[model samples]
Structures are given as C-alpha cells and as structure tokens.
Target: MQTDVPVTDRTRVRREPARGRYDRETVHGIIDAALLCHVAFRDGDSVFCIPTVCWREDGHLYIHGSNGSRMLRALLGGQQACVTVTHLDGLVLARAAFNHSMNYRSVVVLGAFEAVPDDRKAASLDRLMDHLAPGRKHEARPGDANELRSTTVLRIALDEASAKLRTGGPQDDEADLSLDVWAGVLPLAVHALPPVPEPGITRSMPDGLRKWAGA
Candidate 1:
C-alpha cells in the first residue's frame, strides 16, 4: 500500500516549511536516485559524518563496510544514526546577491542500524550490485565465504524520514527584478560518460558492464 513517512520531532523540517515532504514516493525516489549517503553518528566524544554507498530495499536503507571499521561497528551496535542524501539540480541565480539559492532534492533518515542475518547476507549484497549495474552480479565473480565473513552489512528502517526539495527558477524581490542583470537557473545533473574498460583484453564488455557507466 502507498503511504507516507511520518514526521517525528527530529525528522521535521524547520526551515522553509513549504519545502518539506513526507510522502513515501518522494522519499523512496530521492533515496534510489543517489548512489551514496553521508551517515552521521557519534563515536565516543567526537561526532563523525562519513560518506558511503547506500541503497534501499523494501522499507530499509542498507550500507556495508569492513567488519573492523569503527563506523560500521558503532552503527551495527544499534547506535542512533542520521543518514542524508542530496541531489543538486541547479543553481538558482537571482538579481540580488542575498536572494541567490540552489535547487536540490534531499532526504534525511533517522534510525539505528541493525545487522542483516548471516543467512541472507549474500543475497542482500547481490541486490546492491544490481543497483549499480543491472545483471552485473551474475557476470562478475561472487564473493567467497571468507570475503563475506569479513564484511558487515547493516540496514536501518526508513520509518522516520523526510524529503525536502526546491525546484524551478529563483524568487527574486520585486524591486530587484527590475535590476539590469541576468537572472535564471543553471541546471545540473549526473552525466554518465563512456565506459573505460580494463587494459587486459580477455573478452568483450558485457551488457551489464556497459550499463554501469552508460557506455
């Protein structure tokens, strides 16, 4: 059933209330569109915000790292974490310097991460490979038992989350609009360049590999 992510005290958007969003569609889309997220969690007396690969499946967001990693170890221990993903769509230029802004899509998720059971770890990792390049999981060599044992896969519920976005042109002041200056939006996006294959020529590039960088 289609639903919305409920807003909690921490997940609530305080600035520019009009830009806040809590719909499931918006939240899921924003998460899926980004390849990485910045996870903020406290470690001892210091706070750390580290960027890592993130993917969504069902109602949970997933991340992985080496078992010895401090950040992964802290999160898998059920420490509260705040994950954020952002997409900069364009630069909103205005006639007034103070009015200049940016158009972006961002999502914030607050929850404690949990370990994925050992039995389901491989399948979950495969899903991540598919996310980056469809069918690539089958084409590439799979992780062996030792490799899987040394890795830690964790997931956090997306129950407490919100999406905030800004779109279109700038909202310049009435008085500033009359100024003799160029004002508009300069759009931006993630452009996939031609793929660069490895130096060794054992075989041709597979369809799955081509999709990875839009070759």
Candidate 2:
C-alpha cells in the first residue's frame, strides 16, 4: 500500500503505500539486523551502488569508508543517495507454481548525504563500534589520532523513505487449490553461534563472554 505522503520524484513508483510509519519502524528493524547496506547514487552520469557498514543514531544513518574512496568522496560532496536494506525470511511455495514468492522485508531511504566533521569523528566511531558489537568497543584499544583522520564518515537523514514487506503462505489462484503440492511457507532464520576464544589462557574471562568458552 502507498501512503498519502507525497513521494519523492525519484522513488514514487517504488514507494509502498504509507500507513503512519513513514516506514520508520520497518526501516529501522532491517537496518539493525544487518551492518552492511547498499547505497545507490549517481556521480555525474554514472550510477553506483556500493556496500558498506553503517550505524543508526537518532533519526540519521552513518556510513563509513576510506577518505580517498570515490563513492565516499561523492557522497561527501552532498550527492543524493538511496540506501537500502533487505532480509529474506522464508520461501513461500504455492499450490500452483505461478503464485510463488519469497517472504521478505525491505526498506529504501533517499537523502542528500554529507560528511561528518573531523571534530565529531570520535563519537561517530564509538557509535559504529557499538552498532557492530554492543560493549565490545570498551574492550578494544582506543583509536589513535592518525587512524581516525584516515576514515570518512557520511551521514544520511532518515526521511523520505519507504518500506515493502511480504509474508505468510503463497497466494494461489482459486482454480489451482486442488493441485497436489506442499503449499506453505518454509521458514528461515539466523542464529548466532557462540564466539570462539583466542589460544592464550592466562587471566579470567569476562562473564559476558562465558558462552564463547563453552561454559
């Protein structure tokens, strides 16, 4: 369903019907589930979609890469970009082959991206680390001044976006209801295995990581 919110001229067709979410909740969930997002944008006459790690804070998304990278440079120059996140949930098999589709959740966001200032780099890096592994940043070595200067971070405001989702069993035609087939949704999921520990065994391990040691 498409929402009443006026669609951005660039993504009007792809925009799902707005239903009060402004697609924020749905978009946030997909973004949190995966660290990598594909950002699409045009540089001059060429369109590019690059995959990179990102984090969400307040109502904005932060994406990072090398300062010298072309994509990062273009985005830093205030180019319009479309960032997308998707997760495949299951395979929906219908009674008839024609109506088969996969269960999925996806979100697409459009924004004019810009680079974060050097003064804000430290806080941004901390947020990025926590996004990847909560509490892990405090356990690792702090970033040296030189290392921080080499990275480029772009910020994209979380407005002007839409989300599309499909779920449940497949939609089969009435005429094909009698066909003999296993017609249902085959569920799929992701589960995290315990972490692996390093070889040295001298000091007591943190209680938070007990499971990783087979405890």
If candidate 2 were superposed on the true structure by all CA atoms, what would the RMSD be? 3.9
Per-residue lDDT over 2-58 for candidate 1, one digit per residue giving the tens place of the 0 to 100 score: 237888899888999789999988999999888899999999999999999999999
What TM-score, over all chains together, does every model reach? Answer: 0.94, 0.84
Model 2 Cα shift for residue 130 (angstroms) = 1.2
Best by lDDT: 1
Q: Model 2, which residues run further than 4 Å from truth?
A: 1-21, 201-215
Candidates' lDDT values, in order? 0.89, 0.75
- Listed per candidate, the RMSD to the true structure in angstroms reads 2.3, 3.9
The lDDT of model 1 is: 0.89
lDDT of 2 by residue, 1-215 (tens): 43533357654544334322334566676677766789998888999998888888877888988889989888877877899877788999998878888887776788889778999988999988787666767887978898899988888877776666777888899888988888999987665455456888555555544322321
